[model samples]
Target: MSSSTATTAPPATTPTTITSPSPSSSSQQPKPKTKLKLKIRRAVAPADVAATTALINAAFRADDTTDVYLGAEHERISLATEESVLGSMTATDIAVFVGVVSKAAAVDYEGEELEHKEEEEEEIVGHFWLQKKSDTLAWLALLAVSVKGQGQGWGSQLVAHAEQVARDEWKAQRLEFDVVNTRSTLRRWYEKRGFVPTGRAKPFAYELHPDWEGVLRADLEFLYYGKDL
Candidate 1:
């Protein structure tokens, strides 16, 4: 199936807890604080194709124990290659956004860098594609976040950024996407972000991939979800 036809499952939501330090533990050493920054921007072809493709495949890898089955041996339900990413980048109606994460450096009072600086590190942790479907409608697809990046609200950030671009840049009045019907968790995640089911669905186009001979559930279908901008 084309990446546009499906979306990767959303990151699992985890609750946050806060605790106060006890007076008896005042002697404990303070741990170093590290802050991470996320930047979401339109991807550039060739330069971002490989990294974007790898991140998508890594994030979309299927879990046989939980995901709707494709086969025991197949680790991924959808895969993206450099060529495929480049193709999307070149499409006039499509725009791809990538989320990059890096450790934020602290500045001294004099506006100079700290001597104990951490090495410059960055990673492409998440990505999604937006396609202009009509003058007032756009489609979101291929949303994925790496395993390490999950549970940190990065996926939500990507979705929010995409919606802004769709509305401000594309002049779209609505945005929509399809999720596998079996993925109730993923659907609910989107619902929390203001998307609601459109009461529409279509059969998963497994027949399109002749090489995929794995057994699939007979009732698998893509459920439409949408939000008005």
Candidate 2:
């Protein structure tokens, strides 16, 4: 789910909900109500760097669909190093948001168990970055959620938050992003979220710097997409 050139995703179906019977019904039937507890806020100081890096790597590694694309490009599961994560935090144009889930809603990532005390604390399960591209446009990059965090509607919530920040805080009229051209499933996922292909594309070569960890390959290219805020 990271357009940061690390991971891919399959198309996700919309969540289904069943309505409860009227509260006043005479039949002795009732349904319990519960609310999801998700906290979305700016990632904390330097401490967040390690957690974010680990989450992104875990998410991409557990997703086979993601590997199909990244592996072909000879890319590593991790797109960000601790240094890069911390570096982005200080940039004025980039904002990183981390989604912290309540313990009640937490699930073991990829079936990996945590000690009882560890499971009691809230977990940072998802993250994304918003870059102010220009006065009227913003771009979202490296959006990812841990393996167990997906399908819980948290991804959509993060996207919505990005759109709101672009419009309300940045005064931007549009939000843009790019995806590996080969990941049709991911493209369709964004399509459902109101993004449309813009007919613009760019090479996804990981040669942005000599120290970058992602491998450079000829098959990688990014296809651009955008949404009106």
* Cα RMSD to the true fold for all candidates: 10.2, 11.5
lDDT of 2 by residue, 1-229 (tens): 2223232221111000000101111222222133244689998666787998787666554534332334433554445567666655656667889888755446433334435555466678778878787899987877886555455667788889989999999999999877767556667778888999999977654555444344333465677899999
**Model 1: residues with Cα > 4 Å off, grouped in runs:** 1-35, 62-64, 70-78, 103-121
The CA lDDT at 138 in model 2 is 89
Question: In model 1, which range of ten residues has the least summed lDDT?
Answer: 14-23
**Best candidate (score: TM-score):** 1
Candidate 1 per-residue C-alpha lDDT over 110-177 given as tens digits, one digit per residue, 9 for 90 to 100: 33344454665556777888878899998888888765544456678888998999999989999988
What C-alpha lDDT does candidate 1 achieve relative to the native structure?
Answer: 0.63
TM-scores, in order shown? 0.74, 0.72
